[model samples]
Target: MHITLIVPTNGRPSLVSRLLAHLERQTLHPDHVIVSATTPNDIEVRPDISFKVSYVFGDPGLCAQRNRAMALCDGTTDIISFFDDDFVPCDSYLETLSRVFREHPVYAVVTGDLLADGAQGPGLGFDEAVAMLDAYRPSSLPAHVRDHPGAYGCNMSIRAQVIGDLRFDERLPLYGWQEDIDFTSQLRAHGRIVNIGQLWGVHLGAKGGRVNGVRLGYSQIVNPIYLIGKGTMQRWFGIRLICRNLVANTLKSLRPEPYIDRRGRLKGNMIGFAHVLTRRADPEHILKL
Candidate 1:
């Protein structure tokens, strides 16, 4: 049961260091560990680790870096664990994740609780908002969140066979955002995606700078439309309904963000729509914090 750990980075040495240290401490060490940094000089792994270290540099875009790393996993690698550069793994991560997959190999994918870390009391102004968004989130307790391909890219694993025909959609415009969802949705169509509770991962939880301003729509807007455009959705969500959802979400998100002007948010969305409609807009270019 040799597992491949694939992590991608864009030159964040601090987070990368944290991830490597955590991996070194894993109870079931991976068979191979590969890091894909955006630049050649970004590889600075310590030489004393027990596993293999392979680095692929200069691959730009989210999916490209990941795809390159996957290749490094090689055909013999049985399982591949994808982690964001930011997540610090617990000692039991590999043991538990591999255990669940070994027991339930039929599922195409599995994800664990990406519990949010830091400032966890209810007093934070964004607390309710975070709750609102996560309220409907599919949990992986095995009792639930156990039979869907909708898993987060960070801290998830896939058996090599299930991933042979699937790859991240590199056509996506940006480095971050809804590419994870889109990929998961595609995997769901082919097989089951489960939440494996015995395995848990923590998100260091950086929204970048978007926390200061409401992130109007990308996940909330464009990709859904594109999914509908590609006929990937189970039901049609017309432009009108999508707009309404976007506006409603904007309001909810705006509650804690003082930087966004409510009126201008709507106005800017409209303007952005025109650009999208006129062939001048690219969802990848949307601002992220």
Candidate 2:
């Protein structure tokens, strides 16, 4: 299968470097790897890498950058896989993905199990991440592959032929919250979207190169409402999401946790909820926050 990998990043060169190293050890390699950044110089490429690497630049939003990278793919590319710059895949990651797609012709999208920092908590160190990848192995069988509602943007792959000309919603703006659900939900019309437990990976959950807690918190509320208004999300689902985030942020803010901005997120969620109550909620308000 002719597969291409796309990673959209913003000033996270060191993390990208580690991801490249993991790619080198993959049992199945991509025909091409596209690294999309805010500027061409933000990425430093290693000439010793075996696969073909391409560096491209675009606006900083994740959705916009990914779309730019997808446009650069060769027309014949069969599958396009999206991986967050902070994700560290197991050695058999690509091999497992390729096998699922090859075996299930009707599968339109596959989302891998995204573990939190290799079973370690947040702020995962580089050496620890590499070590975890080195020692990883598949722990389950065919039962691991099952139907899912949507793809997880951190680690998901789509069949290029099946999702022709589709791109992420730029209106979702920075961090592009729920962009994965919005995009993958559209693909369900074409075929099944499944979660492959054996194709697991760890998300470093690095806080850098991301929007502030306020903006993310705003997205947590506004994005869902916007989708619901657009008919992309069910009203019940949107309400549940709003209530859950509000309650979590409210409760957690009284005593903030390490590596999390409980207070800031609570404030943002309250602001968004107020807007919604006043009938003035807008997704664009996230930028203003």
Candidate 3:
């Protein structure tokens, strides 16, 4: 299978370089790798790597960058895999994906198990993530697969043919909150989206290139609702998601974590609610913030 890896990044040239180096070490290397960024400075190209690496500049947003990268895929490509700049996968990650896709023809999309996801808490350092991946060993157990509403953005792949005309929603803007869900929901009609345990990775969730807390918080509330209205997300799921983030941000603001800007997020959540009540909520508004 010819796999093309696409990584959309911003404001972290060194980190993107490091991820490219890791891709060189994959047991089954990608046939091609495309790094899409907002500006040339957002990535540092290294010609020394064995795998083919193509760097391109696009509008400054995750969804836009990803769409720009996808436009580069050619007829020979079988699978299109997306990885965040900070995600580090096991050496066999690509190999496992090939095996699963070959064995299960019903799956149109696949996301991996995350060994350590720093996005859930404080972010992890590159060295720490590398050490964690190095110490790990593949499970002897058979690969476990589960149905999912959407693939996780950090490490996911889709059959290129299934994505014939679909693209990331550009309105999601920076960080493209819940973009995976929105895109994968559209994909679900083509084939199944599954989580495969064997195709695992570590998401460092590096904090340096993230959107501001206010914008991200606003996205947390507004984007889900936007998706719900578009029929990409269930209304109940969207409401629960908003409530969970809003409540957590509000309560955490009272005694904020050192690594998180809880107060700023709470304020953004309030702003999102205000906009929603006035029928002015839009994911693109994050650009103004």
Best by TM-score: 3
Which regions in candidate 1 have their CA more than 4 angstroms from the true location?
41-43, 117-145, 207-220, 233-249, 252-272, 276-281, 284-289
Error of 2 at 213 (Å): 1.4
* lDDT values for all models: 0.62, 0.83, 0.91
lDDT of 1 by residue, 129-182 (tens): 234323544444544446652567766777777666677766554454456666
Model 2: per-residue lDDT, tens digit, 1-289?
8899999999888788778877888988888999989986677778778998898887889889888998898787888999999888887888878887889999999988765553233477766767776676656455477886678888899999987888988888878988888888888989999997878777887778777778878888989989988777768877897888888888878887777887888878878878889999887787787
Per-residue lDDT of candidate 3, residues 60-163 (tens digit) = 88889999999899999999999999999988999989888888889999999999999988999888988998998877988788998898999999988899
List of clashing residue pairs for candidate 2: none
Q: Can you give the TM-score per candidate against the true fold?
A: 0.74, 0.94, 0.97
Give the least accurate 10-residue stretch of model 1, judged by summed lDDT: 118-127
Best by lDDT: 3
Inter-residue clash pairs, candidate 3: none
Candidate 2 stretches greater than 4 Å from native: 117-121
In candidate 2 the C-alpha lDDT for residue 117 amounts to 54
